[model samples]
Target: MASSINHHVMERAEFDRPVKILIVTSPYYKDIADEQVVGAKAEIEAAGGTWDVAEVPGALEIPTAIGIAERMSNFDGYVALGCVIRGETTHYDTVCNDSSRAITLLGLQGLCIGNGILTVENYEQARVRAEVAEQNKGGGAAAAALHLVALARKWGGPRKGVGFKPASDEIQIAGAAKGPNLA
Candidate 1:
């Protein structure tokens, strides 16, 4: 089975500066969410990083909170933690797909985010994944975010002006005296 294969777990990433990460979680499943937060916090602390926690109403709100924080706060990265167990209704599929998609879209937008939200068939599965002694998906997610932050630091900064460029005439230079004759 996939679980039987020996996998390399990277050592905690080191940061030259104090890396601050924001963790957004849904306490809908309190036990699962708490476990995830515990694991995430442990990983971040081990990596020489600091973190803040925020609680959202549900999984769907996790990304939204991150988005708001990305715009209004200065966190270096984000960790999303939640658990969505399958239900008898179609709501399960919608929650699972939409939440995952939102997290992916945010990552593609250049936000360093670790998605630890669990979409499982039952509480048992979530228990196994969320347990720090078992899979520890929470720690995995925090590690993922740290790795992305390290990569970003290695690259220095993001590319500037990727999509659009102004023409020569459209570029305005500062400190140059404007000619009075030019209308």
Candidate 2:
């Protein structure tokens, strides 16, 4: 199994300026969610970063909350935490796929996000992954976000004004300003 193999976790990345991370979590599984939050907080703090958290009703809302925060807040990055276990019905697939896709779309839009939402077969698996001493998926997610932030800072922000630019000497007409013969 993947867990049986040894893996290396990189050291916490350094940033020139302070970083603030927003943690949006779905607390439907309160215990698992809490554990994830704890691990995420520890990792961020260890990297000389600060974090704020918001709770949502379910996994699906986690991404939406982050989207809102991205628009309304000045957070440097986001950490998404939640747990969705397989159920007898197909609802599990919906939650898992939608939540993950939303997070990916946000990331593609230049928002640094670390997705820690656990999609598991059972509660036992979720417990193992969420525990701070075990898999610590929350911590891993935070670290992922931190690395991305570091890379962004290194390259400066995304390229701006990449498209065509109008000639500075070109005359521009305003509404109702002139007829074609006036020029």
Candidate whose lDDT is highest: 1
TM-score result, candidate 2: 0.86
Per-prediction TM-score, please? 0.86, 0.86
Off by over 4 Å in 1: 158-183
lDDT of 2 at 11: 82
**Per-residue lDDT of 21-115 in model 1, one digit per residue for the tens?**
99999999999999999999999999999999999999999999999999999999999999999999999999999999999999999999999
- lDDT per model, in order? 0.93, 0.91
- In candidate 1 the C-alpha lDDT for residue 76 amounts to 94
- Identify the runs in model 2 with alpha carbons over 4 angstroms from their true place: 157-183
